[model samples]
Target: MRTAQPRHYLMCRPTHFDVVYSINPWMDPRKPVDTPLAIAQWESLRQTYLSLGHTVETIDPLPGLPDMVFAANGATVIDGRALVARFRDAERIAEGPAYLQWLREHGFADARTASIVNEGEGDYLLAGEWLLAGTGFRSDPRSHAEAQEFFGRPVIGLTLVDPDYYHLDTALSVLDEKTVAYYPAAFSPGSLAVLQRLFPDAIIATDADASVFGLNAASDGYNVVLPHNATHLIEALRERGFNPIGADMSELLKAGGSVKCCTLELRSAG
Candidate 1:
């Protein structure tokens, strides 16, 4: 069933949120989040999407890779093309099949995945007339040029510094066609300057708040999932004219994600 709106987003449930152990190199793994807590958190966030009047399709939770819910990071749909992403990690390597099947069934004639190993949605940001893909942490630096060749559109690469801001969506958000929320630190200085030049009016969220991963915590055209108890940030967003909503994403955060990572905006699959 198609949604009445021009866009429909997708998300998955978390089966083993606590099973995610992001360490061995330097990433923090503050013990595993209890499984029941993860389910409750996912449900709470999912309810937020439903409340926004979006058509939500819930998928089974995949173990090990708790971040599987944020499908857009692995693949993006735009202008009827499914740009499958190359995952940088082995865990998310097998996460593209379902999205491809979705493309085939939804009537998209042209579909392809990037040949790199960057599986982070935060690394890719869709903007006016171009796709701004990020590099540094998860995405390969070369994918930018490759994506440009494949899509025929200029694929500008963003600067990625940390795993926390591994995807472009983690630091960039389109509040509307004209306005956006950004955290310059998460992106390359060059990308930041270019984005500012292109969208001077786009709201640039403070770097401190960007650390919360809430900069990407926006969707449904009128809502945002703020970290629980971020009253100041929430009020600041409202001050900037956002209708910030609440979702206790503590469990998802345990797996290094938030509201944005838990959903995929399926825009015009046909």
Candidate 2:
């Protein structure tokens, strides 16, 4: 049986959620946004974590920063050390400092902002002893070295090819310390080869599921929280003895984020 380990996560409420600007392919300002529904969906995701025995911390939402609700882009926390993001887009530049300040005041003494453009966990994901860093869109390749030095981990650089899946979290998710689920089409040929070589048993997602941001998930070893519409992934996860919990982030999808996008894992030294 797969045992679930409780995790600590950071999230932001979508109090001022809106889709006024386009940064990625998923964002289309022409579409109308339902802020109330977005908030409800976000709350459900948070409650799901709590029900699964995880600790959740919140940061105050700043107005005019609609994307701030996608807290995973805020910072990457490992061993209690936070390397806050330096967003690539001018629209989110202020977010880096805001997240850095929050971490500094809220017990992460080692928290510091990144020098290069790296969109926090949006481009950086921790899987076991390695840090899976993504580039090609929102993050700079140079930030890979910066992350390695800050977190003292072996960082493997992966290049994203699909504009729709601009962030690493959007294209892939770490299911546990060893396993991962990813959309092969979202990565470059070299990145795909690296993923296959590293995680031979990784769960591969279909275009149907990947398009729904189903790969944008969070797992506590056993329970995998993902989009409900990803039927194939849910079945595959169940076959692997994982408890796949479905979440509805359709409203947040307008802003190019979902479960994993809204979640920032807070790791501390064992």
Which ten residues in a row are the worst by lDDT in model 2? 261-270
Model 1 lDDT tens row, 1-270:
111222466777777555345621223565655768777877887776677677776555555565566655657666556677667666677676656666566676677767776554556666666777877677788877776776667787768665566667777776655567777776667777888898887766775667666675754445666665555567766776667786777666655677777766655633
| Per-residue alpha-carbon lDDT of candidate 2 for residues 1-270, written as tens digits (9 for 90 to 100) | 898999999999999999999999888999999999999999999999999999999999999899999999999999999999999888989888989998899889999989999999999999999999999998999999999999889999999999999999999999988999999999999999999999999999999999999999999999999999999999999998899999999999999999999999988866
lDDT of 1: 0.65
* TM-score of each predicted structure versus truth: 0.84, 0.99
Give residue 100's error in model 2 in angstroms: 0.8
Which 10 consecutive positions of candidate 1 have the poorest summed lDDT?
A: 1-10
lDDT of 1 at 10: 71
Model 2 segments beyond 4 Å from truth? none
How many pairs of residues collide in each model?
A: 11, 0
